[model samples]
Target: MAKFKLFKDRKGKADQAKNNKFVKLGREIYVQARKGGPNPDANFGLKTAIHNARQINMPVDNIERAIKKASGNGENVEYDEIYYEGYGPGGVAIMVKCLTDNRNRTAADVRSIFNKRGGNMGESGCVAYMFDQKGILIIDREKFADLDEDILMMQSIESGADDIVTNEDSFEVLTHPHEFESVKSAMEAAKFEFSSSEVSWIPQNMVGVEGENAEKLLKMMDAFEDNDDVQDVYTNFEISDEEMARLG
Candidate 1:
């Protein structure tokens, strides 16, 4: 959910590590294009990666360069997509997504972060059962000032979206992984702009974290995010807005 601790600030915000974000996004673009070819129209994953790049204001030149590299112009070395599951402080389930050239190095990096911060890295499928891969789309409330809530719901439902969620500030549309593109196209056709869109590992339930454990967990998460190989990190932990503000 958007209210989840890390995502609350991440949503509609510029990434803190811009250069790392560029590398991560570029690698994803390259992988998708390499696997499915440079044509986004025929490759759903590449199309989604491109949309995500634009959402973060990645330069068009950077995106094109990545495509070219992936399309046989550059080294074209394969990067492996790996998932590392672990438990953070206070039993918080953590799932890390990575694109790496070296499995041993990535595994060691992830394991060290877990072990250093009162966490335990586990075997594959360790905590993955707690999450679902869902297509999430965030719509800024101010962007479509004239849109009615009912109309938005109708469009989302008819477009094959799985669920609609809302907060005081924005609307979120969820869709199955297979239906993501069709739903996104429908929303775009209706002129609805998204603040963010991605197929991510969404936690099925949330765990509460506070006090020192929360502090340690945040540090651990920061370590993971700062890793060049780490692409995305998901955790089941949640903290109140007040607690989050205080952490700041």
Candidate 2:
């Protein structure tokens, strides 16, 4: 399998990371609802945010509370969506998306993590141009044991998918940002379900990281995700399978 920037593996720290995921996801849902209103059916962003939260088994109560907060029935905090760009230990481009009520605090925390982890924060557009914003939907192979890859590819293409990448355990459908909802809806109408779905900044090219640099890069990403203000992170770094095994 190609070493794409899948951040699911965290050097055996999945449990720790998951504990913090709910808070960040709650913030994301709140921000989305606040921006587009609390009605998920009428708000695509809110619907996607709620879908992602549910995918992780986030509590229904938490999801509803976030919507209530956004609707002015709960907390009145307003968050700003911000993006930070930088280079990791191996000169791999990294972009962090944040939703925070306090910009200065989030900026300081991000900069400190980067500096302490053998990285340096760059100007706003420094690494943004190296990535493409696309919608990615992942379908597990195990879930559709009888579905052939060719047929899936054909369906994806006919539904306006930009590309279909067959990974070792799943099929990743890529779509233009504007066409994401259409493609996803078409697949759902055909009784297909996604393992995960999101619009993300995909790296145009990957930079290999090994040895000490790879370890440091992973730790750095964990730090970013552990932060309360950070919503998601994107990177161009790719670690070898051997290195990943060693890290595990």
Candidate 3:
């Protein structure tokens, strides 16, 4: 199993958990409604979004209000989902995913962050070829004590999943983009409690950063994640457990 040192400590989890769920839910509603329709039951993406929002303890009222707002007559905030590729310290490839109403504003903000962090943003397709976009489903381990790993794996494979990884705290299932819904439904049928399900870019190869370079790269990643417009960030960098402990 490949362990990501970036998520080693509980500090990031605690900090993110404090973020206002209303705001997050609002963004999700906006994206889903804009992409599909306001009705979650009729829209698979919207249904997934709402499910994920609830999983994070977002208030029901907030979720409802967001849906209502999206359906009602209002200034439609047109969000364009954009991805930026760049190289951080030690030549670690980084990909940032953002949803913004203005592409120019988002691009400038991303570029500024990269520049400040001693990194440079690259042209489109520069670093993207090094990654594969896949649907990832994450589930909490405590929910299923008697869970049959082999059975779950076989079910996922039959439902179009490409791989499965079980960790100490969670189980991550990977699937093709088109089969995401099917695989997710299979897991749900098996009574699995999903923590999150989304399409993300996974790096095919990883770079090893150490010493000063690793510190700088981590700081840059933190800054990118803190941006309001930024939704997700992916990188192909591997850090050892010892490095994670020292940083933590």
> Candidate 1: which stretches are off by over 4 Å?
1-16
Model 1 local distance difference test score: 0.85
Across residues 167-190, which tens digit of lDDT does each residue of candidate 1 receive? 667788999988888899999988
lDDT over C-alpha atoms for residue 247 of model 3: 72
Clashing pairs in 1: none
Candidate 2 lDDT tens digits, 1-248: 11333656455667777768889889888988989999998898888888888888999999999899899997799898899989889898988899888999999999999999999999999999989988899888888788888888889998999999887788889999999999998988877789778888888988889999998888887788678898788888888888888987
TM-scores, one per candidate: 0.91, 0.93, 0.90
lDDT of each: 0.85, 0.85, 0.78
Clash number for candidate 1 = 0
Stretches of model 2 off by over 4 angstroms after superposition: 1-12
Tell me the deviation in Å of residue 179 in model 2. 1.4
